[model samples]
Target: MKCLPSSLLILAVFPLVVVAKRRRVPFMNCPSTKSSSGLGMVKQARSRIECSVICLNNPECLSASYCKSSDGYTCQLSQMFLAGGCSGLPANGDCTQTFVVYPCENGGTFFHENRTCHCVDGFIGDYCHRRYRDCQETPLGNVLYTIQPFRSDYTFQWKCGPFTSPYTRVSEYASVFNFNYTLTWEQMKQGITPHPGFYFTGPETLHQLTKQGVYDLFIRMIVLGKNSGYVIYKHFRVDSEAEGYACHWKSFTRYYEVPYNSDEYLDGLGALGDSTKSMKGARFGTFDNDVSECAGTHNFAWWYNPLGCTLVTFDPDGLNWPTNRTGTVEIEKIDHTLIGLRNVYWYVEDDLIL
Candidate 1:
C-alpha cells in the first residue's frame, strides 16, 4: 500500500460547476367557492397571493382557494380535487375569490424546462413516482440490512442524491475515521475496526450465525468522486485486533477438491494438496482454499483475491461497477475536495455452505 504524495498541495481553488436553470410552470385558476377534497391545513396566509405561493411550493397541493370574508382573507389548499366534492359554500357578496393549481404528475411539484419532473428525495421518473434504484431494493436481497442517514458537519453540504434522507445530527469522530467514503483494507482495519457502532450485523436479537455459517453485515459510505472506491472484508467478526480478513474474489484458481466419502483417505488431505489425483471419489469445492479458510475460521476472516473482487464507483447518475479498467482504486485530496459524496451502500453476498 503506497501513500499518496504528501506534497499533493491541496488546491484551495477550483472552477465552479455551473448548474442548469430549471423551468417553472404557470399556475391555473380553479373555480371560485369550489375547494377540492383532502384539504390538509398547511398554513394561514394574509392574502390570496401568499396562499397561491404556498400551494405552489407544496408538491402534494393540487389546488388552493382564497376567500375574503368579514374576519379577513383565508386560504385553503387541497390535494385531491379531480376526485371531486366541494367543502365550503360558494363565495358571494363582496367576498371575491380565486383558485389556482399547477399541472404536475406523480406528486411532482417542481417542473423543469425540459418537461421533466424534479422529483422529491427517494423518487425519480418522468412523473417523479419511481423510487431511486438504491432505495428500491435491498442491495443483496438475501442479506438482512438497515439504512440510515449519514450526517456530516462540514461547512459545505454533501451532494447526496435526491433519494437520500436529510442528514441527522451525530457525534463527531476522528478525521481519520470516515466510513462515509471508500476506504482501503488497511484503512478499515485502522479506522472502522475500532468503531463497532458504525456498522451493523444481521438481526441484533438473533444469536444464530448467518446461513453461510459466518457473520454477514451491511455498511454504507460516502462516495467521494468518480473512479474512487473501497473494499469491504467479508466474514467480519470482532477480534482483539480488527485485522486478517479477505474479499471473496471470483477466480478458477480458488476451486479445489472436497472428499465425497468420509471414509476415503483423501478426506484427511487439505484442499491444497495433490491428493485429489489418487482419490476415487471427490467433489470440487465451489471456492478455493483461501475462501474456505476465511469461512471456516473461528477468528475473524474474509475471502480476498485480487482478480475476482471488482471495484465500483458511485457517481451522480448511480453505481458504476467494475468496467474494463484495472488497477487499485485511488483516492486523492482533490477527489474529496472537488466533490462531496452523498452516500454509498454495500451488500454482503456470502456463499451458502451446503
Candidate 2:
C-alpha cells in the first residue's frame, strides 16, 4: 500500500476553497401583536432588528415577538408560531410585533407567503431534517429517485431534480466524504486530520449527520494505479457509533448494493458480515497511532481489519473489489473514494404505501 505524496500536497496547496453561499430568507413580520404563549426563550433587545437577529441565530427559535414598553424592549422567542404568527392582540396601542424565521433544513424550500416548508423527498419534519432510509419507510407522493453516478469533482450544489408528484430519492449524493481534500501525509502521519474545506466532511461531522436517524451508505472507489479506471460500489447500513466520535462502529450489515456500470456489477461489501465486522469495530487509527494495526502499513488512517487487514472500507487504500467472493483476490491501489450517506428516499409507489 503506497501513499501518493502528491495527493497529500493538494491539502496544503489548496488551503482555501469557495463555499456555496446560503440563500438569505427574510423574516416574516407581524405588527400590533404579542405572543400570548409558546415562548421558549426571552432576552432583552433594544430594537426589533436585534430581536429578529437573535431569532435567526438560534437553531430552536422559529418565531419571536418584540414588545416595547416604557421601561425597555423584550424579545420573546418561540419554538413555533402560535395562531399563525401572533397569539395575542394589541392592547392600548402597545408596540408589539412578531418575526417568523424559516425553519427548514437540508435544502427544503421555504414559502415566505405561507410560512411553510416544502421538504425535498425523504425528509419529513417541521424543519426538513429527518431523513427516510428506504422506499418502505417513505410516505407516498414523495419525489422519485434516480442516481447519477461517478462525479469526479466536489461541490455543495443540491443534486435533487425538480419536485414532482411521485415520491423518490431527490439527490444522487446527499452527503459526501471526500478523502482527496484532507490533510497532507505529513499531517496525517502525525495522527492529525483537519477538515477545513467544504468538499471534505470529517469524522466529527459524519457522527452528527448519522446520529439522528437510520441511514444507508454508498461507497464508490476510483482506482488510478494498478487497476486504472476501475470503479467499484459498496453499500451498507450504519447501526451505531460512539458519542462525539465516528470510529467505534458496530452492528454493521450489508444490505442493498448499487451497480457502478452496466457491464460490470459487483457487491464487494457483503463480505463484511464475518470477522471483518470485528475489524470495523476497531477504534480509528492514524498513521502515527496505528490503532487498527494496519494504518501504518497502508499509509492511511482508518478502522482497519484486525485480522490480516482485508480491504473493505471507505479508506482511500481500502477501496477494493474482490475478484472472488471468498475474499482471496482483490484489485487495489485505489486513488480516490466517494462515500455518501443516503439522506433522501428512493421512489415509493402508491400501491406500496400500505
Candidate 3:
C-alpha cells in the first residue's frame, strides 16, 4: 500500500474522534437527591399533579419528573421561570420559594423575592408581561420578502456578543427609535437607464474607489445597476450602564441594514451623512418591481466586530464570541481589537450615500 499524506490521514481519523467525543448522558446516572426509601423518589411521572407535589416538597426542585411509568420519580432542582403550561396546579401556590428576580438586561441579577424588576409602572398584567419578540423580520438585501406569515412565524435568536453593542443609552434618544423602516423593491422608485451623469455613475464610481469584497461588491453593483436600499431598524435596550466619576459612559445600539438606495435621493445622488443620521436631502425611495430583482440581499449582521464599541465585552474569554462563524473573520487578540469606537461606522454611512 502506498503511504498516505499527513492531511489525508488526519481527515480519516477526525470523524472517528468527533463521534467519540459526542456528549452522552448516562441512562441511569444523575445527581443524588435525598430519598424516603433510601433509593430516592425514582418513579414514573404519571401526572402534572404528581410532578407538582414532588416539586413542592423538595426545596431544591424547580420541577419534577417520573423516571419511568412503572415506579420512580426524580426532581430536577431550583429556579422559578415563568410558570405556565401546567394545567392542574394552582398558579399562585406553584412557585413560593423566596429568591431574587431580574430583567433580561439586568446582568442576570437578583435583588429579593420578585423585587429586582418593577413592572415599569402603568403596566398591568400577570408578571407585568410585555410581549417577547425576536428581531424584526424585515426584508434584507434587495430581496422583496413579505412580513413573516400569520399563525406560524419562525423562531430566531440574537446572539449578540460584545461587538454588536450600541453607542447611546436608550433613555437618551427615544425618538431615534423611528429609524426602523422597511421596503419592498416595490417600495423603491422606478427608473430607466438614462445617459450617464455623476449620479448615474455611483456604482461604477464606487467600484473604481473601493476594492471588491462582499459589502463593497454590493455597493458597486447597486450603485451601478439598480440603487441603494435600507434595512429595517434594529434597537438595543440599555442592558446595563454606570456613570463613572471620571465622566465615562458606555452603551450599545443594534440594527439590521439592508442595501438601500435611491435614484432621486435627497441630495440628488450626493453623499450620505453620518451612519446614524441621513443627509438633509436624502429622501426614502421605492421600486415597483420585487426587491429580489435588485442587487443586495438583506441579511443579519452583528453590530461592530470583536471590538465591542457598543457592547463592550470587558473580557472576551468570558463571553466566548470571538469569531463571526460566517462572512466575517475574527481579529486576533482583544488588544489587537479595532477602535474609533463610533467614528468609523458614522463615516461608513457618510461614504455610502448615493
TM-score of 3: 0.17
Candidate closest to the true structure, highest TM-score? 2
Worst 10 residues of 2 by lDDT: 4-13
Best-first order by lDDT: 2, 1, 3
Task: Quantify all predictions' global Cα lDDT against the true fold.
Answer: 0.29, 0.40, 0.21
**Candidate 2 residue spans exceeding 4 A from truth:** 1-200, 222-278, 305-308, 312-321, 325-328, 344-354
Give each prediction's root-mean-square deviation over alpha carbons.
Answer: 21.1, 17.0, 23.7
Which digits, one per residue and each the tens of the lDDT, describe model 3 over residues 245-342?
A: 00111222222245533222221011122233221211221222212221112111111211112221222121111222244433212221111111
* Per-prediction tally of clashes: 10, 7, 41
lDDT of 2 by residue, 1-354 (tens): 111111010000011231212222334445433333344778989766566657655656656666665678777776664444454533433444454433556778765434456777656544554453323334543234322211112111122222332211211111133444123334432222223212333343334334433345544444433322222222222222342132433243333334333122133333433554444434445566554466566555455545555454334323444433244454433444444565433222111000
Point out the worst 10-residue segment of candidate 3 by lDDT. Answer: 6-15
State the displacement of the C-alpha of residue 349, model 3, in Å, after optimal TM-score superposition: 36
Among these predictions, the greatest lDDT belongs to: 2
lDDT, candidate 3, at 344: 15
